[model samples]
Target: MSMVRYKAIIAYDGTLFHGFQRQPQGRTVQEELERTLSKMASQPIVVHGSGRTDAHVHALGQVIHFDYPKERPLEKMRFAMDTQTPEDIAVKQVEIVDELFHARYLVQEKVYEFHVQIGKPRSPFRRHYASYYPYPLDLAKIERALPDLLGTHDFSAFCASGSSVEDKVRTIYEATMVHDEALSELVFTFRGDGFLYKMIRILVGTLLKIGNGRLEETSLPKIIASKDRNCAGPTAHPEGLYLKEVKY
Candidate 1:
C-alpha cells in the first residue's frame, strides 16, 4: 500500500497539557496524539502541529498532520485516536490531503480571544479560563485605542523582548472589544496574518492599562515608536488567551 498522509483538526483544553509540542517529562498534546496514532497504524507516527501554544492556552481549531504506511478510513482513524486520547484533547475531524500539504506553512490566518472578567469577585467556573480585574475600566478609552492598533506597523514594541524574529511588522485584520453583561466578561478578539511571541498578551496588557486610566489613548503611538518592551504593560495571563480558529 502507498503511504497515506492525513490532516486532522484538534481541539483541547490546554490547561491539563504542557503545550502542543511533546516534552520529555510532562504530558503534551502532540505526545498523546502520536502515541494513539502509532498504536492504530502499528508503526511510529509523528504529528506536526500548526503552531505551538503556551501552557494553559486553549485551542478550538488546532491543525495537525501525520503519515502512515497503512491506509485506513478517516472515520476509523478519528475513532482510533479519540478513543486513545485523553478527555481534554479531542480529534474534531480528519481528512486526506496532498503529500505536500504542511500544517504550519499552509495557514492563512489565525484568530485569538482574550477573556477578562471585571467585578468584585471571580467566578469559580471561569477561574481557569479568564483573567479577573477588580477595578472598573473605561470602555470608551479602550475603543479609542483600538484604532491605533489597526493596519500594519512595526510591533516590536508590543512583542516580548527576547523574540528573535527579525520582522516585527504584522497586519491586524480586525480587533474588537466586547462586554457581556450577563457573563460579566470582557472579551478581546483579534485576527491577524501572524503574531510574534506574546504579542497578543502584550496588546491586551497595554489596552487594560489604557482602560484603567493608567495610560492615555494618545500615548499608544509613542509606545509604538519607543519599540521598547518596557513601554507596554505586563503580559496578560496565558489562561485568559484562547486560539479561536486557524484559517487556511
Candidate 2:
C-alpha cells in the first residue's frame, strides 16, 4: 500500500493522559492520536511527536507527523479528526509536508511557558493550569539569574535522571520572567534550541528558590559548571509547564 506523510498541530489539556509518549498500559496523547488516526484510516498508523511531555503538563502547539495509508485532502483529514477526537485535545492545523520533514528533527527551536500562581489561595480558574506557590518572591533575585542562563551551555544540572542524551548541552534563546498583575502569577517563558527531561522545571525551580532566598542568586553559574543534577534545585510540578510552540 502507498503512504502519504501528514503533519498536524495539536493541543491537549494533558490532565488525563499519562504522558505524551505511549506507555505499556494507560492512555497517552500519542496513543490517543494514533488510535484516532487508525480508526479513521481503517489501518494502523504510526505517529511521531515533536517531544514527550510529562503527565499533567499541557501543550498549546504540539506537533506530530504520521504516515497515512489513504490519500486525502489535508483539510478533510484535519476536520475528520477534530470533530471526533476527545474534548481535551484539538487539531489546530494540518498539512501535507515533505516526507523528510520530521516533527522532531526539523524543529529549530521550542518555547515553553511555566506559570506559578503567587496568590495565597489559587483562583479556581488558574488552579489546574498553573502551579501554586504561595510564598513571597524577590523578583530582582530571579531577574539577576536570567541572563546567566542564556546562550549555549552544558545543562546537565537542570535535566532529570532518565535522559540518556550524552550531550546535555542546549542553547537558551530567551529566558524571561513576567508578572501578570491581573492573574497574580509569575510566568516564565523559555525559548531554546531544545530542552531535556525536566530541564525547564528544574531551572524554574532553582529560580523560584532564588526568588525566595532559599537559594542564592549566584548559584546558577555554579550549577551550570557543576553539570551535576544534585547541585541544582528541585523539579517543579508538571501542571505549571506548557509546550507553547515549536518552530522549524
lDDT of 2 at 32: 84
lDDT of 1 by residue, 1-248 (tens): 67888999989998988888998878889998888888877888999988988888888889999887877788987888877888998888999988999888998889999999888679998988888888768999999998888888889989987788999999999999999898899999999998899999999999999999999977788898898889988899888898888888
Residue pairs that clash (backbone atoms under 3 angstroms), model 1: none
Where model 2 places Cα greater than 4 Å from the true spot, the runs are: none
Candidate 2: TM-score?
Answer: 0.97
Q: Kindly list the per-residue Cα lDDT of model 2 for residues 1-248, writing each as its tens digit.
A: 87889999999998888889999987799988888999998899899999999999999999999999877877888889888788898999999887888999899999999999996778889877999888888999999999999999999999899888988889999999999989998999999999999999999999999999988898898999999999988889999999999999
Q: Candidate 2 lDDT (Cα, whole model)? A: 0.92
Q: Which 10 successive residues of model 1 have the least lDDT summed?
A: 68-77
Q: Pick the candidate with the highest TM-score.
A: 2
Q: Mark the 10 consecutive residues where model 2 has the least summed lDDT.
A: 119-128
> Candidate 1 versus the native: TM-score?
0.95
